[model samples]
Target: MTNDHAETPPSGLRIPAEPVPLSEVARFDHETDVLVVGFGCAGAAAAREAAAAGADVLVLERFSGPGGSTAQSGGEVYLGGGTRVQKACGFDDTPEDMYAYLHAALGPHVDEEKLRLYCEGGVEHFEWFRACGVPFQESLYGEPGWMAPTKDGLMWLGENAWPYDTLARPVPRGHRPPVEGFAGGLLMERLAAAATAAGARAHTDTRASALVVDASGRVAGVVARRFGEEVHYRARKGVVLTTGGFVDDEEMVSHHAPLLSGHGKVSDGGDDGSGIRMACALGAATRRMASVEAALIVMPEAACRGMLVNALGQRFINEDVYPGLFSHAALHQPAPWWVILDEEGFAAYSARNPTAMPPDHVAETLAELEEELGIPAGALETTVTTYNRHAALGEDALFHKNPKWLRELKAPFAAIDPRVLARLAENRREATGISGFTLGGLHTTVDGEVLHVTGRPIPGLYAAGRASAGIHGDGYVSGTSIGDGTFFGRRAGRAAAG
Candidate 1:
């Protein structure tokens, strides 16, 4: 797969950042046609696909068990483009519509080739998951929330939200597998079983330490530590890295993603930048390293009834936007945002969020509350006046909040501190703390070939999942990570076997 015009690294080929080297006279302890490192959604999908394609595949996992970060997720897979669930839910969607929505959502970092390929193959990928025994019910989740609390298969995770609503007709495409309790863990469980059933072997407690390059400067295998022994696993076809992102690595986060420093972390353990660092040592270029996804959800559905205001008490974002999107905007604003709510709104919020701190200030009038919060003299009053006027008319002229949540604000106003709301809220489903994960890593082609710093594919090396960056830009919609991981993982597996 070498391009004649591709730039080759200078002599003294730097090995991966691990302590060991490819020239350490390593002996092959295990051998396979395709070797996969890190058995999350990406690794599992790669292993299963490679094995299905008649390749001998071996998977190495760091943890002593299954389920990386994917298991802890909400198990929402972003699939549309006329997916079975979307069509079953009576929604008409086309690849063009999906592509348009993503193009607008991802902004400047959107990869055209990747988006095209993903949209075109979206339905096939969804079917692939079904073929692997991942069960997706045919029901549609009626609410416009993040994830389905039941076995419902389809949900509008990103419909009627900013940018997307204007680009194409909104459609519901978030597909969740029918796994009771935590859907993510069930997803990993089924995928892991499918990988093994497809004749792929998995070695847990094995941590890949370095990449093995041959005399031709081509990736030949992996060096991993297993049972206190340095073992070299030779891969005749290729090695695919799916070791997730660097959210757990504080040093790397500070260096590459400092903006995410203060936000809460919702990561599965062992997401510590090792995968990205390893690829970097071999001269893999990184993209969007500063891009991060921070969910700043403060309350449950009750939050939709209120308005989000900055320290200046000026309404900023449409509170009805997907909580994840709202959270992303929340991170950039000046601190000390207050969710302005009236008595009925407060009652609805408090019914579920009883622990939310007592209002920073409560007054019989919005003007008095504005002064108590130290916002400019008439800023809060004017904002409320305009908001309530439009709300009473069932319209949100400024932010276009969904009419369902719009209501006129009355006396006895209370400004709730978001930090306190985040703390007191019950859980991620009810109230999500400001949390984020890294979305940037080794740059790769849509097919998952790891690219050199000079825009050429590194021979015999591939990456997927959080180990590779291409799907989303700085902004994120729910379910994209898991979908990207599995779809690209299959692509990497097929490409490696070729």
Candidate 2:
């Protein structure tokens, strides 16, 4: 392969990263039965599946090693259809229950086929990860937070709290690998090793710049830049693109998901929208482009035991929903948010989370605290009075907050601004900020076949992971990304190998 034609754009290109024609290629540098682009959780799983299916799989990664955004995650895989771990933890979860919660929580645009398949196959998927050397313990971390604080294997990562709990039986479906803290790195380590062991060859620091299409408009291979030179790699069977999302691309984020522009990105800088653009050039359809996972983690979930109020000092959300759902609700509320806590509540939060942000304004009375927070004279007082009245009866009449978290607000109040805490954490390079990632990409079928704008599957081209939108529609659950990516990657790999 030569670099001379690499800089030239295909004629009448729809996007800057359009696919190249097979006729334009003078020679082929490499060939494989399946070409897996970007060695993230999805790519690793895809490579392993395709190679195990007796296909010559080759994985290309832009980074120095495996592990994309998956390595930066908390390593929680949402699985709950009566798996052994769930049984060991004394939780009876059925596929119907899992589907009910996910269908209700994932969105107004949920893909029923994909959701049904995922729910029904949850147990087998769990076993598959175990077969890949990913460890899971039977212990459960019963907490109301984002990631598990302990090495326990299970936690609730979604709206498995009050309101949703009423709809479906709540279960701890978020299964973490048995690692002390932030085990995403360990998860990817095992997955990458599994892929390589399955005979999938990987070339790191190789960037796939464009897709190659045959005369009939079928994807044939990829044109990549490696070692300061252009290389053409032909995929005799198919190509799978798993290059994550577009969160790291500021221009793409601002245009597609403007709401996520200012928030911190939870990526490793490889989610630049290049893979999406390349696929779109071949008439691939996209969905939920405005969808982004905005995490508003007000640490020491004990704060939910108090009250989350807006600038008007009015309670808006239940305060006990999943942190991501709470954050979405918070984003729609008035600016300058605060979690108002009484002395007892503040003391409890401090005792539990020593690193929790200190109260921004403390006063001996609710009236004094209201004044300090610049709320209207009687707004804060009236809100707290009403909340306390309902709370005294162990009931949240207005918001339907669970009785377990409802409590009366006494005197000596403290207000903590979560926005300030997020800013401070961002400055300190911590993951505590209001970080997020784009949740939308190329539209694909449950088999990972990319769909055309006319609802037809694009032959010889497939996508999984963030490069192609799967389970997530509007909101996000913490473990859904890794779970969806790995599960669908296998399906795509198998389909491509055939």
The runs of at least 3 residues in candidate 2 whose Cα sits more than 4 Å from the true structure, single-residue gaps closed, are 1-15, 158-160, 428-433
- Per-residue accuracy of model 2 over 180-279 as CA lDDT, tens digit each: 6688998999999999999999987788888999999889999998766888999999999999999978788898988776777778756788789999
Task: Give the lDDT of residue 36 in candidate 2.
Answer: 97
- RMSD per candidate (Å) reads 6.5, 4.0
Candidate 2 achieves a global lDDT of: 0.84
Consecutive 10-residue window with the lowest summed lDDT within model 1 = 1-10
Clash list (residue pairs), candidate 2 = none
Cα lDDT of model 1 by residue, 1-498, tens digit? 111111122333422465344577457888999999988999999899999999999998877666888988899888888987888779999989888887776655776787788888889989999988889999887665556657898877667766568888898878888854368988888999999999999888787878888666678888877666777899999999999998877777899989788666767746777678877878888888887777764653545877888778888778776677777787778766778888888887677555545556689987788788888888888899999899989989998887888898888888776665456543434333477888888899887899989998988899999888858887777788888889999989888877
Please provide TM-scores, in order, for all candidate models, with all chains considered together. Answer: 0.90, 0.93
Best by TM-score: 2
In candidate 2, clashing pairs total 0
Angstrom error of the Cα, residue 154, model 1: value is 1.1
Assess the local accuracy of residue 440 in candidate 2 as a C-alpha lDDT between 0 and 100.
90
Model 2 lowest lDDT segment of ten: 1-10
Per-residue lDDT of 228 in model 1: 65
